[model samples]
Target: MGKIKLTINNRVVEAEDGQTVLEVARENGIHIPTLCYLKDLTGTGACRVCQVEIEGARTLCAACVYPVREGLVVKTHSVRALEARKNVVELIVSNHSKDCLSCIRNTNCELQRLCQELGVREDAYAGNKTPSTFDEVSPGIVRDTSKCVLCGRCVAACKKIQGLGILGFMDRGFKTKVGPVYDRSFNDVNCMQCGQCINVCPVGALHEKEEIHDVINAINDPHKHVIVQT
Candidate 1:
């Protein structure tokens, strides 16, 4: 693709013709927040947090996947864009499990960081969240469905890097989920234990199995001895 020149937030910037507005904006020091747009992966544009206002466009566009054209005029932080982004995030938060204090990815979660960035102080549509499901069936990984943002980064990682296709989205709508094929648990599947799913998961949905308490108990037992490695 040839070079394309565009104006972002009043500053002129140049980027490749095929580059999305989000990529160009970030390259030029303009931060467009995202949740489902992982680096080095095709953007799903599922999380509308990266929406930006473009001149002559009737609605805000998803910066993560919206291609930039020559002479394009875009506003990365316009009032309308902010409100729409905030609303999208709020809906996600409402349907999400808000137990960040005790969650595994508390301080390191992308959703939490985005909420803070957008100044979301309270839930605008709180209700019964989806039923929580905790599955530690895998010896090396834990699956927490409640914390999943449905971003599909883990699914992408498994398919692209591992090539195992061990996980995928199941069911539909509010009941949708990512898991092993045929609704089987990871313990029952041929999961390779590569931990790629844990690595790509943006929230607390996937993580290393927490066996610290078991180790501590074994250490304190009179007849038991535990060896540790870091």
Candidate 2:
């Protein structure tokens, strides 16, 4: 498609007609926060964190999926947009286990980075937390549901890229979750054990099942000098 000219935060910018508002904004160095948007994957617009106000729109639009149009005017960091994004983050944290100090992802988690960047000092929207589940039956991967933000990246990674629909979304609203079909453990499914979901997960919800702890336990055993799995 031909180039389209649009105004982003009072500055004129041009992007491909087919480009999304998020792509155009990022390409021109206009920072718009997002959570459920993974580059190259089809955006679900689930997070609502990338909402931006368009000059002619009645409500804010999700930048990741909103196609850019000529003569369009967008406000990326407007008061309404910032507040809405902040509230969205807060809601995500409401049921989220905020035990970042002990999480494996720690400073590397995308959700943690967003909290820091968005100046989320505390989670204002508190409620009953989602029950936690730690599925370690799979020899290759571990799942901690308490840390999942339901961003759907892992689901997309498994279904879209790997052609394995082993994982999927179920339920709805605050009670929603993503996991192996029928909410069964990963071991029960035909999971490829490829670690694709773990790699794309933005939080500590998924990770490799490391053996470092087993090795350490063997080293501390009083009556053991050497341990062999074979």
TM-score of each: 0.92, 0.92
Return the clash pairs for model 2, or none.
Answer: none
Model 1 pairs in collision: none
Tell me the tens digit of each residue's lDDT in model 1 across 1-230. 78889999999999998899998999999998888888776478887889999999998899998999999999999999999988988988888888889999999998899889998889899987776567888789888888888888888899888888888888888878877876677899999889998988889888998888988898999997667788
RMSD of each: 1.8, 2.7
| Over 4 Å off, model 1 | 217-230
Candidate 2 lands at a TM-score of 0.92
TM-score of predicted structure 1: 0.92
Tens-digit lDDT string for candidate 2 (1-230): 79879999999999998999999999999999888899987588988989999998999999999999999999999999988888889888888888889888998988888888777888697779876677999879998888889989998899889998888888877678889976788898999799999989989999998898888998899988975776
